[model samples]
Target: MKRKCPKVKSLLLRLLLFRQTRPVFTEEEKTEFTRLYDRIIQDGGIAPYDSSYPKFRFLQYLSVTKPLLFHGSNYQGIEEFEPRRQTLFDGTYTDAVFSSADGIWPLFYAVLDRSGLTGNIRNGCIVSRRGERFYFFSLSVESEDRYPWTEGMIYVLPRDSFRQASEGKLYFDEWVSEKPVKPLFRLKVSPEDFVFLSRTTWHRSTEPLFKTYLLYKWRSKFGKRK
Candidate 1:
């Protein structure tokens, strides 16, 4: 199968142009965060991003990675999450355990460029049991301005699945099975700024109201794409 090359320009635009830098929490502020983490774990598991009208079952697994910090600072910003994996057998496809390695941590922010459509979707993340590993699917939409036509939905699939989708062996429509097609709540963000959680979700930005930027450490595996 021909491997799909990463859409460098689009990825860079989302990471460097639309992302907003989050404020670093101070050590004193971390006290509350620690408490919140403990409280969440104590309450069985943190509810899925949306629970009011749950369509998918998303339970919190332990956090395995730490937060990504800003350059030359002790301040921590973005966090990484580790989810439980599962195995599956499609009958047609050889039975295999599906799992996703946590990608490099990311810093998320959004721009309010007001040049295109802005919307949200619910059940943004999906997980399927496939044995000892789990298959993950994540999606997000980006709104952009005129130049490169910046708006579209992004789907992140397990590595193998991503390859298949890119090869045309698997169609994106059939591959993605999301309930509550649109997000229940809209994230009010300016074209200049947006927020993101690095670990569990895949996100994108459109309608470039303002230039968005992202700062993150490079991983050897993914290379220096940005």
Candidate 2:
């Protein structure tokens, strides 16, 4: 793996490293530059569905009436948040800290990880164009045999540094800040509390990791045609 490639070989071979887009996501946000955040949110981890429970009340509490802004992650003890360049195309186009007015949206990032999976997991969260909230989760056969559950954390940030990033027309409810900010509170969220994962359209792909990256690049290139 230490071998060096000749310039010819390197150029002829589409290593695709520089070709990958680099968006300034939050520090703990783990994703390929070519991959979609929505795809990552749901396709990022393996989770179990709660057939016994009929509702996700905590998620509802977070999404509906929770005040202040919210950010979620798989890591803990993040005392400070630095502004990074996030070009999400959701209209939050600046170097800044990002969070959502609705807590449930941040939960999508909190409750998922690729810790032991050999392949992608089935998962996603969405608020419909019609205002319906939804989420879903399932594991690949290999993942099911390897890991049992998903773990994540939710951090509540002070809103003094935040500003509405997107217009209210789409009702996206996204917020951003160009300066560094610190969390006022952090909580370890249970997978059961994330029952909201079963809500929106789930995005799942079991392709090998390399293949998925190439596929994402291909799509990004072709989808940009005028």
| Prediction RMSDs, each to the true structure | 15.8, 16.5
lDDT of 2 at 226: 10
**What tens-digit string does per-residue lDDT give for candidate 2 at 131-174?**
43332333444544443446777776667778876542123446
lDDT digits (tens) for residues 1-226 of candidate 1: 2344333333443443222222244454354445543554344221222222111111111112222111010112212212223222222432322222221111111221224435421111111121111112122344222321222211112232211211222211112111112111111122122122222222353423222123222211233222
Model 2 segments more than 4 A misplaced: 1-67, 89-93, 114-149, 199-226
Compare the candidates by TM-score and give the number of the best one: 2
- My TM-score estimates for the predictions, one after another, are 0.23, 0.49
Candidate number with greatest lDDT: 2
